[model samples]
Target: MTTVTTPDAIVTAARGWIGTPYLHQASHRGIGADCLGLLRGIWRELYGAEPEPVPPYSRDWSEPSGDERLWAAAARHLLPGGAEAPGQVLLFRMRSGGVAKHLGVQGAVGRKPTFIHAYSGHGVVESPLSAPWRRRIVARFTFPEV
Candidate 1:
């Protein structure tokens, strides 16, 4: 049976990964996971197997080539252009004129919004969606219906 993916469920699943170590291209819950890996783990919990295989990626994430590879992958797998809400996937551009690479799952909305992500040094954490972070958001998306 296919599970109905809900915002609350997504948030809960992401929250479960809190404190997981940040490992490049790894997706094992509580052990290691990158930002994309966090989303992949949540996708597995909500839907089953991943829709596609993820090739090895570098820390730059195709930035040197000026390609939005991560954004393109997200567009392929997720429903784009969703209203800001808990559980939405947030794509961020870490700097001006750079490829959007960082990702986070929206945790709390409205006043004092937060997002859960696996940062380089901090591991998995739910941080306030402060203005600096908000300014870097390049796109928002929701998981596809199962």
Candidate 2:
């Protein structure tokens, strides 16, 4: 992978994994990856190392504990902001009253905005940032400038 230095580079790297199969906690491109795995993969491509070791986690890892573990971790490694520009990391709450766990990379902005994510049944896809999906967005972050 080429060095990822700009937001455009981040978006390009993420878009390159468009068809990767979805597998829980896996990060290998074209083989399998969950939402977080997608982010991890991008981080590796950009920085050549993971910011931190991610312990094994289940689909409902933090539901019982009611903790925002994923959001907390993103905050630790990503730049916090409300910018809706391309390449931003988006955090979503899949269900009301639950932790925000779902993640996606912003792919486009302006009319017909889209985001790339690894969906369970659909593998990796770029989906329209529709109103229903928009409502679930809890936080937006960008990769630190390297």
Candidate 3:
């Protein structure tokens, strides 16, 4: 894999995808991408290709599958970033009894933290990291070796 020489470069690359729509399984810029696709796009821009080809997945991919597969995969590739940090990847469990599936990028942290994510109808949005959203986070990741 190609190396990402700088952290700002990662942020810049992720920011470039701000307006893309949330189309499941796509990883193209200006066209469409879901939350994971946004990260896939960033990985491609930073490293020239995805570390591993993603398998076909459903919207409820891990929610009912009863496995923390996404979190596990992230653990293998991304450095753990503690609880709060700008530009960190945040994983969310959409329900109380479901597996962690949803993912987002923390854009700000402190009194008024915010995260960027692609919601089904909202597309890509930087949302306030409110208590409710905070409660669902299962893992946090920084780019590897950063």
Candidate 4:
């Protein structure tokens, strides 16, 4: 059976992961999860299994190679180019000319937008989509319809 998921449901599921410790390449809820791991966990919760197996990655995430691997993977699996909405996946370029690496789930929109993400040293938390963060956003996407 195809499971229908809502944006609110996605946001809720992401919120449920709050406080998960940051662990490189890990995706277990409440135990450890990196930004991508958080998204991977949410995908597993929404769908039965991941669409593809994730290969081991370093914290730098292909930065030295300047490959847009994360963005490419998202575009391959997610519905790309969606309006800013709760549950939208956000891809961020942490530095100028850097390969987009960071990921987050839109938690709120409008005047005071927020996003849920697993930040190193902070775990999973809802953070304001502040100016600096907003400026770093390179792409927006929504989960595929299952």
Span of 10 residues, lowest total lDDT, candidate 4 = 1-10
For each candidate in the order shown, give its overall lDDT on alpha carbons. 0.94, 0.92, 0.80, 0.93
Q: Is candidate 1 or candidate 2 better by lDDT?
A: 1
Model 4 pairs in collision: none
Give the least accurate 10-residue stretch of model 2, judged by summed lDDT: 1-10
Q: Which residue pairs of candidate 2 clash?
A: none
Residue range 1-146, candidate 1, lDDT tens digits:
23867888889999999999999999999999999999999999988999899999999999999989999999999998567899899999999999999999999999989999999999999999999999999999998877
Tens-digit lDDT track of model 4 for 20-136 = 999889999999999999999999999978889999999899999999999999999999855889999999999998899999999999999999999999999999999999999
What are the clash counts of all predictions, listed in order? Answer: 0, 0, 0, 0
Q: What's the distance in Å from true for residue 72, model 3?
A: 1.6
- Clash pairs for candidate 1: none
lDDT of 4 at 133: 99
TM-score of each: 0.97, 0.96, 0.89, 0.96
**Local distance difference test, candidate 2:** 0.92
- For model 3, the superposed segments whose C-alpha errors exceed 4 Å read 1-7
Writing each residue's lDDT as its tens digit, candidate 3 over 1-146 gives: 33663545666677777888889988787888898898888877766767887899888886665878888888887888875777788999888888888888887778998888877887777789999999999888988752
Task: State each model's C-alpha RMSD to the native.
Answer: 1.3, 1.0, 2.1, 1.5
Give lDDT tens digits, candidate 2, residues 12-78. 9999889999999999899999999999999999988898999999999699999999999999999
